[model samples]
Target: MADSIFKRYLEKKNNLIKNRGILQATYVPDVLLHRDYQIEEIVDIVAPSLNKDKPSNIIIIGQTGTGKTAVVNYVGHELERADAENKNCRYIYVNCEVIDTPYSILYNISNQIITDPNKKIPFTGWSLEKIFNELANYIDDENKIFIVVLDEIDMSFKKNGDDIFYYLTTINEMLKNSRVSIIGITNNSTFAEKFLSPRIRSRLGEEKIVFPPYTPEQLIDILKNRAEQAFYPNVLDNSVIPYCAAISAQGSGDARKALDLLRISADIAERNGDSIVTSAHVDYARQKIELDAVVEVIKTLTDQSKIVLMSIIKTPSSNDTGSVTTGEVYTTYVELSKNLGYNPLSQRMVANLISEMDMLGIITARVKSFGRGGRTKEIDVNKVSNDVFSILSSDDIFRGMNLNQKLKKQTTLM
Candidate 1:
């Protein structure tokens, strides 16, 4: 029976191919044509001080998907290969988003320096000062030049302030000859400047690299470069690559988003049993990405935001009305707060909460031009009712809520 089926299948003209999207990272070429300006700046910083024993630090500011992380990784790999000849030089990278807080971040660096796995530091329950002192000693003992890359430093600072900055910068002053350098990556340039004290800001001011968003044409080149390796011959529609590039370029010239769009469009094509990805597949993929982003935003929201959203969901005309006024949303918010047995705050506070929700893409607000006589803003429920309901029901905090009943009411209200 297997032989007969194999024979029948072989008789059919087949064009199935392994997807190129699976090899995403490999497909990303090492060339930095569009990012040459940034590469040149970073190289200058590293080159001048490579032979010197004094510690150096660099602060890199770039929006997401402008190849900040990629360029750093690429340069890091090259540095690693060069340093293999001399064991005294070392490079390590940590995404502060993953190792958030001063203690955790310091502990990670300490672990890299000290080879003892059994003496690993705990995530919490230790003072930041103790961790820093211990980590500084560990680095000193290594007697090697260390380069540390801290990606998403903004998130780290937001969680734990400038304490880590103080530790890293001050450690170099205390050490005798052991060199330490930090490559700090952040999406917000103003965040560090505004929050950090002048002392720490001046230390970080030595090397500043700002990366602007990519233009549509530049992004097209990036997409085309990756497409040649990711897909089989003629497997993608001619328009799909440019469409994905244009969409991503508009957002921030984010290469990651562009790559993701291409990957997702190919998956969509395969799901529909199509031989190649078309414009329709790319459009569908965009909708899917939007929904996924919204879902992820919903998942990370605080309990208070969920309560406010649930209140919006309870309203009968929210979907049709586009947005409920701030006052109306406040009323519903109070009702839900009561039902959940939590004390409700004032409308001003609720408005702030609504703004946070809007930032998270849970909802959108429209500012009405009310001829100097009306409210400045109105709240809009931008997401689909079902999507919001699905996300809320998945949360551990909202686990026991009546999802079906609430969603039923919302659907009826539609």
Candidate 2:
């Protein structure tokens, strides 16, 4: 009887370990799958320009998760190593998401130059103008050639427009000693060109490069590399990682997606009390990761949008309806909103709300054309049906809802 209990315990423990997947980004090694040629091309573009005519800036463009940032980051380190003998050239990477506006971008560059670690500019929170002047002074004092990389350049442009890019590119003209060059990286190919004025565009369009998606085979190699570091010996079925790589390759050739799948698969494996990650774990992980992503995205919606989404979840045939008509969804939206204390919105306004939810990926809209008579749009809730109900009913306004009943209502509608 003791032996039997111990055997059962071992089985459960082994099942737990198998559920955990290897191959997460934070844990993955840097063996790039399909990016070798792209990396080398970028290195050539950014390598210390012998002429010192302000290291010419380069822009990299690709779809999301296509290794745009990773390639640039990897190349930056290589450039640093290659240029170690030449003290004049330096590589600096800035995530525009964090630094944000052009002033912040320039200020960050100035701080890097000052390198005091604890030093601050004397001006006490002056306007962006005064800050720029101080930053210019610092750059002039440094007497070094710096290449700054702005990742997520698209986000910066969307937030504050091209004024920052204009400033940074032109600021070097004021410097008597140091010179500045910039490398803008983005997932949006049309980002810089669309946002900048012709003159600013002219200055920045100098050396443009594009990184393409990885082939499935390449992604498989990438998965293998990450798995070696992330998993125990023979923990993952050989086919599972490749299966994940193949899925991500279809979407955007995103290494991040592949890595996320591998990690989530392992977690699922651990939860199921398995000793090895199997094909089943990978499939389950994909659905789970996708659902979680949709749920988190929906949670961030404005209260009104969430209300509109919750209304759809309770609608008849949520997916088959494509989208609930604004007219159809508005009544439920209002009831939920009133319970939540929001003033009911007009149908025209509800139309806007539908669009907002569509943008958040919580729902999709289908417009029915009435020839010249006009059009009516319908809405469909996508992947967040389970959580949308929870968010809406969590408020006292939805206190009477029986979750099982609501679920049944959803079933009947579908």
Which prediction has the highest lDDT against the true structure? 1
Write one digit per residue (lDDT tens) for candidate 2, span 126-149: 577777877778777767677888
TM-score of 2: 0.83
Cα lDDT over the full model 1 = 0.75
Q: CA shift at 293, candidate 2, in angstroms?
A: 2.4
What's model 2's lDDT at 307?
Answer: 66
Q: Residue-wise lDDT of candidate 1 within 199-250, one digit each (tens)?
A: 8888865788888888878888887877775677898788988899899989
Best by TM-score: 2
| Number of colliding residue pairs in each model | 1, 17
Off by over 4 Å in 2: 1-22, 26-28, 50-53, 122-124, 316-327, 334-342, 368-384, 395-404, 409-414
What's the residue-level lDDT of 174 in candidate 2?
88
lDDT of 2 at 10: 68
Kindly state the number of residue pairs that clash in model 1.
1
Q: What are the runs in model 1 whose C-alpha is more than 4 Å off?
A: 1-29, 49-55, 116-134, 300-356, 367-386, 389-414
